[model samples]
Target: MKVLLYAEAKRLLSRSGIGIALKHQMEALKRVNVDFTLAIDDDYDLAHINTVGPGARFVANSCRSKNIPIIWHVHTTAEDIRNSFLLSNIYSKYAKFALRKIYSKADFLVFPTRYTMNIVRKYGVKVEGEVVSNGVDTQFFKKNEEKARQFRRKYGLTGPIVLCVALPFKRKGIHDFVDVAKRLSQCHFVWIGSKGLASLLPRDVREILRNPPSNVLFPGFMPQEELVGAYSAADVFFFPSYEENEGIVVLEALSCECPVLVRDIPVYEDWLQDGVNCLKGKTNTDFEKAIEKLISDKNFANELGKMARKVALERDLTIIGEKLKRIYEEVLEKHGKKDE
Candidate 1:
């Protein structure tokens, strides 16, 4: 069946997690040979929408009017939106209301993680939902020493590299990253993502980006090729996000077999085991200690990286694509039965 895969603000979200997830979705669909198109105006049997903007709402409504099944990919929730940008917290309550109303309208809901599904359900969203991870392209993100060296040389990054891939926001733990960087001055801290909406960012976040610690570097957004090299070059992939539907960068890091240290949060509960596949921390002090341990003990870090790659294998794009294909067919069959 032809599926309409739609994401609003395509260019704007190109560097965001939602955008990256959408890219993965496209790649997944391609692998499964699913007939899909991004053009919202294209005719299709089913629609999978990945944004909460007015355009997304219009598409959902149009699909409903046509009796076509709509799969709302819940990439953002009110809970995760707070502390994101300026006035984001003030807008979160309204976002919850909008999300509830729109989610209720969908024939199905798609959550990237069970944690996110539970949160949306708590928002009074009762629609049938499934947990489909925002999978990574393992082939592209695997470790490459030559590429790693090229990236390190290009950025003039020397010594042990601590990398974090995320937008500069408070909720993303940018402040905490800076604090940890200060504590671990021996390692080079590189944050590889964009600051696109700088005007909307909180003043304090802007100040931190303006005057970061000597050890920390903000090289802005990198192309996917460069991202693979960054992950390869990194001695540690440290993600301290306070919240996420599913941090695609974490999966990317795992696919590269990069040793990862993340915040002890609900989204990573079942998948990420502390001191097993990856390390988890709560505060800056916890992060500091974890990084020190990973950097000092090469053998332990290598073991963790191996386990982390295994985790990535389970959520590869091919697997996610096949799951999406099944979910689409199941929904279509049910819709057909209703029509019959």
Candidate 2:
């Protein structure tokens, strides 16, 4: 059973979550021994697309004509896309309409979380769909003391480290992160993301990026290897994202045994427990308290980190690969194509 896997605007979205998810999916498929091709082939049994653009629309139409099942991975919704860049909110209405139309063409829609599924349904996406997390590679993100030391040395960072891995967007709580940095002047705060797309950012967000707090460091776009080291070195992973489909970095931090403190968003309801594997905060005050608690209670923080690692193991790529294989088999079976 050969599959055609495609992601629209692959080059443009290289630093984005959508692109990262697509790359992970490809790796998972490879690990599961799923036969796939980047380009469309006449003998392909299915076409799995991960974006809604002109090229994606063409692929969907072609698949429909050939009676090949099309699976659409829902990575972003109009709601989540809002506040992500300059004029993103203004374009959200059109994005929703386009999403509804494109999703209707799919034989099935794959949502990374139930929260995302609910969002799409609320926006009138009436299509068959299922939830599947974009799992992390535990082996790659595992804690390494030496690597962590190197990462810390490179940045000349000392004291407790507070980290957040996200794009430079206001909706990601970048402003809130700055506020937290100001409130906790003693802790070294590092935000690993891109600032090169400043033109796409709103004026306020761009201004904040240009002038961050002295304690805050925006070590823009680290490669995965270095990122894993940062994850390991960080004392706490503080993510105050106002919105998210499913924050993949949370899983990576957990995989590296880093205690995480995230915003209390619907996306994390199923996977995160306030005092179990992670700490959830609603307001800046709550976030400050959570960070202070983690900092003061090393034993409690370590316990949570251990539990978080357990959670990461459950969502490892090997396990996710099995889930994907099952989904592929089921989709093919429904289309009268035997898995064998």
Candidate 3:
């Protein structure tokens, strides 16, 4: 089910004080008697249904045939846009009018972050939606300062550690991150993710990180359980990406009481306050300043770290889950299946 894809929708509802449906989809079939079904092909069970993505392209057609309410769990990529093909990729650019048509007809929409919301809004998609940020198991994210150091040591780092977790995606701005490591030579730098940069990085920097000049460690993509410990060991969480729906790691870092410094992005900005929840920087100069500022002002950095943790605590799924559950009930009600 869609709930299991990101793996939070169901958990969020189960948190106390939020009421969730006991059954859904096929389970609803058992709960109530139904005559015909209007289905989408995400699940191959429905034999008679339209098989379009977004389900918007066939909205006019579906509306004419059936009177069922629609609920869509949206995940937007550049492919969904009609204008993406303008450059080259077919999914990137196709038909702008069709894209607008889909947005206009959708009955209900879901969004994970303002970053995702902004993209859909580009095509004038307007509908009531909830900001269901990716959820993390807070009980499991406690910081392990000693474990962090040990992992640093195991990775061959022997200095203050800054950990960047992810792949070599250009939008993540790895080049910018490396530039920071170059400037801050006293402390160690660590990159953890799927691929190692041993081949890509300049030998001098790689050598320093690997052996001497201050201790830099690269332990490419490990299990999340180990990654959580790695996060526990680091002094700060640094993410300098250009695009992100919501930095799930930010929550993980804050839950672990680690200081976080990220690019001033919409998803981060919406939840974090500069100099308050976490430190944010935009460009080379901006990141340099944040790194320097957080490193030099230890007391200030600690204060900001506590602020970040507190902010994260305020939105624990235990509390925010109620909003999602309420929305789900309202959506089902619109189908003449539930009542006010």
Candidate 4:
């Protein structure tokens, strides 16, 4: 069956998590040989929309008029949108109201995590949906010793490196990341993200980025190839972000067999196992202790990394593609368009 996949604000969110997720999902659909197109053609059997905007609202209305089953992919909520960028907090309530109306119009919904599904429900979204992870590309993110060494040498990261891939926002725990870096002077801390939106960051956060500690390094954004190498070279993937629908970088690090230390959030409950697949930290001191434990105990760290890799393999692109294919077929069947 043919499917029409669309995302709003493609240029604006090119470097954001939602953009990355759309790319991965499209690639997965193509790999599975599913008939899909980016355009809004009249001959499509199903429509999947990934953002909320005027264009998206028009598409949703058109689908409703044509009796086409619409699948709404929920990537952001009001809570996660707050503190994300300039005026995001001020507009969050309106965004939430719009989301509630948009999601209620969908025949079916897709949530990247159970945490997000529950959040939407609490916000009075009555639409039904299932949790499906935005899986990672294990082959692209695999460990490579040569590339890892090259990245380390280029960045002068000789000691244990703690890597955090996040946008420059207070909600992403940028301040917390810097605080932890201050405490651990011996280890090298690298945060890979853009500073172009520094105006959106808090005044203190901007100051911290401008004059960070000697051990803290802000290499800015890197290409995918370089990012794969960075993941391979790092000893720990420390993500202190306060919110996420699902942290795709955590899966990327896991695919590279890197140990992870993330904030203790409910979203990770389904995948992350404390002291097994990865460690969870609640506070700055907790993060410090977790990082220290991983650094001092190489064997335990390796064990956790191995487990994390297994989890990543289960959520690889190939498997997720099959899942999407099944979901599309089921939707078609339910709508009495299976023969189409």
Candidate 5:
């Protein structure tokens, strides 16, 4: 069956995780040989919508009118949107109300993690939900010695590198990242994200960027090819986000076999195990110690990296494609019966 794959604000989201997830969904469908089109006007048996904006609402309404099955991929939640940009908390309040109304219209919902599914259910969205990871392309993100070397040289980076890939938002724990960087002056702390949106950042977040520690560097957004090298060149991939539906960067880092350290948040409860595949920390102090441990003990770091790659293998694109194909068939079959 042909599917209409749609994402609103594609240009604005291209630098963010939601955009990366959407791209992964397209690639996964391709791997499974599913026929899909990005155009909203394209004729299709089913629609998989990736955003909750006005455009997404129009698409959902259109699919409803035509009796076409709709799969709403819930990538954003009010809880995760708060503390991000200027007035994000204010927007989140209204966003929750709008999301419930929009999501309730879905034939089914796809969530990046069970954590997100549970939270959305609490938001009064009773639509049937399936947990599908924002899978990574292990083949594309794997470590390359030449690329790693080039990345380091291009940036004039020296010493152990502590990398964090995220937008310049408060909720992403940028303040905490900077605090941790101050504690470890020996390591080079590189935050790879979009600086173009710095104007929209919260006042405190913008202030932090203005007077960051000498060891810290904001290299702005990097291309996907450069990101592969960033992960490979990093001594550790440190993510301290306050909330996430699913962290796609974590999977990318794991796929590259880079040792990862993340916040002890609910979204990671199922897949990430502290001192196992990766390390977890709840505070800046905890993160500082974890980074130090990973950097000092090379053998331990390598072991964690190896195990992390195994975890990435389970959520690889090929596997996610098979899951999506089954999901599509189930939705189509159910919709057909209802139509009859």
Candidate 6:
């Protein structure tokens, strides 16, 4: 069997955590190399998929045209109603219509979370879909005790370390992170992304934004191994997205045995339980309190981290890949029977 790896913007995902995921796909493709031919492109035969990386739907219809089974994978819902990325008729007319094309034409749909699946459902895109959690390599996520210590020593951090990795979009609640950092002066705060907020903030916000007394670090665009080490070094992982379709980074952190602290959202309960796998907080105060509770009580944090590792072990590549494999086999078999 031959498979096409078509993505419009692979470069956007390079070297970031998202890139790490793309790397895993590349390696798995290597293992399954004999069974398939992975070709990268958006423009091809009508059956060719115009993939926007792993989960974007642009390539779905392209593949469907050739009677190929297309996987409509959409990574981001990307609804910026507050900022308004689309004009009135433009969105309801061509843009959404184009998305509908990808949805209706595909044989199946794949999403990272139920929240993202609901987004497509809300748009009235009727398609068969499943939530396949992104996979993390167990070997890479193991406890690097020595390496973690060395990373902490190099950074001159001895106390608790809080890590939040994400694009600096307004919706990511970067301001809230900064506030949480300022509220806790004894701890060190780390930011791992730089997609939004290049512009200077107002002076008052600057007080919180400014890198303080050797406590805040903005180590930009790290390689995959280094990032895994960073997660190992962290005592707490903060995922403060105002909206998320099951944050993939959360899985990565859990694999590293770092206890995650996320804003209370519907998706969290679907995958993660409060106090069972993580500590979920709803308000800004709630988040800060959760951070304090985690940092102040080391034993609780350690227990939570172990539970997180357990979660990751269950959801790692060994498991998630099976889901993908089954899906692919079903797709191929359906077509084979059709041909018969």
**Model 6 weakest lDDT span, ten residues long:** 80-89
Q: Which stretches of candidate 3 lie over 4 Å from their true place?
A: 1-70, 77-106, 196-216
CA shift of 99, model 1, Å: 0.7
The model with the greater TM-score, 1 or 3, is 1
Report the number of clashing residue pairs per model.
0, 0, 7, 0, 0, 4
Q: Stretches of candidate 2 above 4 Å error? A: 41-43
How high a TM-score does candidate 4 get?
Answer: 0.96
Residue range 126-146, candidate 2, lDDT tens digits: 888899899999999898999
Per-residue lDDT tens digits of candidate 6, residues 157-243? 888899988755445667778778878888898878753344433343345445444566776556566778778899889888777
With candidate 6 superimposed using the best TM-score fit, by how many Å does residue 185's alpha carbon deviate from the native?
0.7
Clashing pairs in 4: none
| TM-score of each candidate structure, all chains considered together | 0.98, 0.97, 0.69, 0.96, 0.98, 0.83
Clashing pairs in 1: none
Between candidates 2 and 6, the lDDT winner: 2
Q: Is candidate 1 or candidate 6 better by lDDT?
A: 1
TM-score of 5: 0.98
In candidate 2, clashing pairs total 0
Tens-digit lDDT track of model 5 for 130-243: 999989999999988889999999999879999999998888889889989988999999999998888998778888888889999998899999999999999999999999
Global CA lDDT computed for model 2: 0.90
Assess each prediction's global lDDT (C-alpha) against the native: 0.92, 0.90, 0.57, 0.89, 0.92, 0.67
Q: What lDDT is obtained when candidate 4 is compared to the true structure? A: 0.89
